[model samples]
Target: MSSAGRVPQGLRRVYLNVRPERLGVLIGEGGKTLRDLENRTQTIVSVDSLNSSVVIEAATPETPIEMVLRASDFIKAIDAGFSPERALRLLDEDMVLIIINLKEVIGDSQSHLYRVKARVIGEEGKVRTNIEQLTGTYISVYDDLVAIIGDYEGAYLAREAIEMLIQGREHSTVYRFLNKKVRELKRKRLTEYWKKDFSTKEVKS
Candidate 1:
């Protein structure tokens, strides 16, 4: 975040493990996604399809770890079932990713996981959409996992909202909770805005 567009010259040889199937997403079609990421982050991102690992290396051993890690997070998001486009949002300093493991809550029953996933998904994706709309996040319900992408507050709020649904909480109750969270987030943002404005004025005075 603090690094913004700056690429440091000391970060090197960081590796992250990803699913082999996900390598396609990380590399993108025809390697377009891979090329785009390398260009944007100024680093070399190598995907080993056989081993299901990604190496984020400095193009010149000078690329900063922060940038590499940022790239790593983006790829992780994709591996977690987020689309590559949505994964890119992690490039923003304030963006956060939260993954909820259905297995942890519901145990090893495949039927239970499927049922719980549907519950979070709602009758026709309505529940998922509502949660995303209210929290301003992207939600992915896939293979016993619930993945969310949003700013700090939105991601966690969405995660809890989804978890409640999986936990058998009433839909209406979860909606209400999300509504309160939205209001709280907006108020906090406004407060921060005013504080920043006031600080600027103080400096001028």
Candidate 2:
């Protein structure tokens, strides 16, 4: 849905579409979720269920578009198969959403795409679960899309692992790579934290 001429003068609005089946999830039980989102963002979310459309309008003319965008992202995460609680994590500034389109990688071959998707999912969702646990990310395989929500580094790492699966790498190989890289990342973060702490202590001394 386009907001080009629909928005009133001096008002900021964002338009987005949720999957028809996910619209109720976006709205929440008895509108509780939608109300919470508006309360937090200082925006009004208008849902057009018939069209699977959502329009987020600033409560006042002074509201920021950033807030609107954030709300949009939250809705999108839900549409991509995240529960509201998981999608709410995007409210944190460091969190992000990354989507991988399987059709693009597998070149319109449904059988190839199915195989790749299976590789990412593994038997009983073990592969997907492993990547999420190791990387601290949420992975959702819906249709031909893989959606991930996490901090930037975690999301990127998850994306890489999925891509490797698509490229026909052995699952064991991917798991090993993830384990090594996650350790490296932890070490790097620890080093940075200690350096910052040392600097603070030096200043105090």
Candidate 3:
């Protein structure tokens, strides 16, 4: 069958597995998020509550291709540790960072890298927020790089703190002083994310 004719023959189905709880968030209040996605990508998105999977069906080959690409990007963002509710927050602003030379301290295992990155970002990003608040910067700890976004002064402070931590600074010391500085910065905060695009774009292009 021709591509156009085959489109209706189950040729445009994309499946996504999401957590049961997240399904509601993705669907949004009154199905706003789902409807937006469908309207934008020109694909019909249906959720299967029984299996917690999303099915995307396109009316045309072109639409399906675009839908798949966009859907994959969304899925990747979620799999990379973002909540569906907060996914859009990252779409416009870049909030990720990759720290180099991390392997030197934590070794190259995937699990170890994640553990170290978690340490850098902290619980619910509290640590990172402190760094940004103190330094007037936004920090994102990714696989192999620590990203810093903010004004010069804030970035400098954050960089220094990260360096100290990596050089074996005691967590207690880092936390105490870092918290103080962030508070100060918040009062005088005047910085921003210099590189405003997500880190993925940097690597891809």
Give the best candidate by TM-score.
2
Compared with the true structure, what per-residue lDDT tens digits does model 3 show for residues 132-164? 666655565644656564445555677778877
C-alpha local distance difference test of each model: 0.84, 0.88, 0.61
TM-score (all chains, Cα) for each model: 0.87, 0.89, 0.44
Tell me the lDDT of model 2 at 182.
100
TM-score of 2: 0.89
RMSD of each candidate relative to the true structure = 3.4, 4.6, 11.3
lDDT of 2 at 153: 95
Estimate, for each residue in 22-93, the C-alpha lDDT of model 1 and write its tens digit: 788788779999898888777888888888988887675456666777787788788888888888888888
Candidate 3 residue runs with Cα over 4 Å from true position? 1-11, 75-86, 89-118, 123-205
Off by over 4 Å in 1: 1-11
lDDT of 1 at 51: 88
The residue pairs in collision within model 2 are: none
How good is model 1 by TM-score? 0.87
lDDT of 2 by residue, 61-105 (tens): 655666776788898888888899998888888999988878887
